[model samples]
Target: MTANPLAPSWLAPPADANDLAASVWPANARRSAADELVFAGVPASVLTERFGTPLYVVDEADARARARGFREAFERECARIGTGVTVYYAAKAFLSSAVAEWMTGEGLSVDVCSAGEFAVALAAGVAPARMGFHGNNKSLVEIDTAVEHGIGAIVVDSPIEVERIASAAERHGRVQAVRLRVNSGVHAHTHDFLATAHEDQKFGISLTEAPGVVASIRSHSSLRFLGLHGHIGSQIFGADGFEESAARLLGLHHELLAGGAIPELNLGGGFGIAYTAADDPTPVDVLARQIADIVASECARLGIAVPRLAFEPGRVIIGPSTVTLYAVGTVKRVTVALPAAFETAPDDSTDPSAHAAAGHPEPATAVRTYVSVDGGMSDNARPALYGADYTVRMANRVSAAQPALVRVAGKHCESGDIVVHADYLPGDVEPGDTLAVAATGAYCWSLSSNYNYLGRPPIVAVKGGAARLIMRGESIDDLLARDPGIGSATRKASTAPAHAEPAPAQAAAQRAS
Candidate 1:
């Protein structure tokens, strides 16, 4: 098959379809002597036999290495620059008791955005003083829970939240450490939805409003202002935005601390990880040094004592440590009409899927293979949600067949439920073959759902040639257990919208009754 016009320019055809790119795959993923894909000494076939298809496999060692890398790199950089640093594992990426326990063992703190995540951290034996709670709109119960637990820092996002925390802390007879979240007004070069630092987003208080919010916290007897925090956005590959965010944030940090001492400055994490060959993520050590130099330079120039620096890198640590395994169920060949918008399409496109569509004639269409897998948007929604890209490989065996342009899709009914929009795969790919998608360790499982009523898959941890089910897949019984029986007399009908009317079947049943 010829080169695909729909394939983005950044995507190059793989020399071998069976080969997995090192940047996106787990550190320990490799092919065994038998030519079967092996991860952490466990073969893909063995994992499927035991855990079933559509399973999330985490390389325990890879995750630990990443955790240790970030911690060590930051500490080393901070020491060289004569500053202190703290590395927090962002639990929003992928969190479980085992993962949290590993983080604690590595001497890393946990950053959570919800009460459930906080509880998980505590359950994993993470010290309350080592946990940070972050959320733009936390409920009163969540606030009270954090206060009662003596959380290390509650990143106060709004002025109203500062008051809520103060009240909650007073009730608990404790002084809470708070950091005012600030928007630096610098937009990160990423998907617009993921770009945060801009003032228009709903993440943090504006740069203009932060000083007053800080003063409000200082007035509360039950609150102690820890410092200022800023998170530009996620999947960021460059240091310019971090430096910019820090420069603006430190100006405020310097101004506020000159009046009163604040000990910490948290530049929130959005470090990027490679999802495909097109992605080039900054190495942890390099990123650490870049940030360290920026902070060191700023503090020295301002003639202020260096405040403790902190980071909350979630995706970078876990994203490359895991892969989603699916069992191919069906394969089809479909011809798609080339839309009129691509009439002037360049032979070298930056992103092949980055095209506008207007219906074109059937003669201009192209035929591509569609490989359907058991999992879809329910397991990994990034593709559907953000037009994210991922790479996949045939994991069951090494095939010598020539590569073909293919689209890996989910079993869901939605046409947009694509896992891999376009990729080169072995032409011999078939049903029952195991397929693996790279860099899914971050948001895939964390954002998974039971859409189409499909049971969620399990997570299997692999280390030292051993594979264990860290989380069990949902069963039909488990799904139904939470569902109130449809005919239950005690069940009350939920209030519908005022403009809503009963369905035809429901109205007919009501009339018959």
Candidate 2:
């Protein structure tokens, strides 16, 4: 059911694995004649040399392509199924003024789960009416801010939030359109997405009580019920999950109408994206078809008019469109007894980071790669959080050297702060070589931190021969500013230890999983 480490992944050898896989890389990503990987034609060497190690590079084209895919999916599905669709790019995946413009420009609306995210959208000139606010435990201030800004609609989770939104909207002399986030109790099969539905995690109202919730919304003259929204989970691979969640939601919609509540229904989005070679995510067009099919069929079965369909996708669109470029800071080799249990494959094993519902195949890893970089969990937490392995390659130069066994780690002061669990990098791997990791533009930067007082990297959008900074690199002064009180009391951690790097552990935990 899962790939064996001994067998390499299909995209093995990695000769051009460093070359931007246009499908997974930014639109402008390419390699220069000098063998330097160019994002938007801007060389990786230039980025690291100018900005230093652990720099964040984005392809403007990649970001835009994802936004456009969502827009196009909605449009095409609307034309086919006749049910209106609104694609809301979830800001939590990765939000920035520059990215906000890209999403809105593609005709996609923004989904802000918090006041801070809303502020970013509104500040970026995203129209208030194009925003859908959602949060389970929204702060009173967040609701107040959303209402004050007149966001398109606030997806209400709990009754407390409803009362707050009502009061806030009333204060503004406006009835905020509200959507009830209903949990359908579907055990959405996913890694990061499963907990959202465990009833233990803070999220939507349960499906059984959604009618009463809808009734309450209808009773509030100050509240306008836009519809019912259901997000089962995230990183979903196909439409079966969507169809099931929609079916449950449509039944609730029918009951609401019978009780004299005609609210719009939103089958929320949690589409998956490929983070590795193994993932085979459905195309936006295919996803659109499935969504439209469910909505149309459900509307007919329930004898209810089709309401506007809405989706919130953060990863699906952004995941493949970006990759993280890192420079190999060190390489070490060690030997340890292979776990006897894993020496032979587990009969029904799984990779937690693999896109849900995708096919499984073996990987070629006769020799695995253990490559360490200057960054770790402090930069990209996915690998350490979900055992998310990545495909890496030499970007700064073409290497004829054989791929070596390696484990990538970060400089975070934690032993568990690993990056790629196992990957193949050229045996010639050295401190100066550039290592390109695909599908990183989504979660990597958004979740990065400044552990060990290490400065965060600058974010640059690469397009052939042109790179612009969206977020600037953190300077030593920026780090010092946080601790003016400690500047005199603190000294950089012992440099001798920094120089005498520890040998890479042979059997490090798969922290990403």
- Would you estimate the TM-scores of all the predictions? 0.89, 0.85
Identify the candidate with maximal lDDT.
1
Which candidate has the top score in TM-score? 1
| Model 1 lDDT tens row, 424-456 | 998778766778999898999899998877778
List model 2 lDDT by residue over 234-327, tens digit each.
Answer: 6777777777778888887887777665546777777777655666777888878778888888888877788877888888767666666665
The models' CA-based lDDT, in order, is 0.84, 0.71
Error of 2 at 402 (Å): 1.7
Clashes per candidate, residues 3 or more apart or on different chains? 2, 31
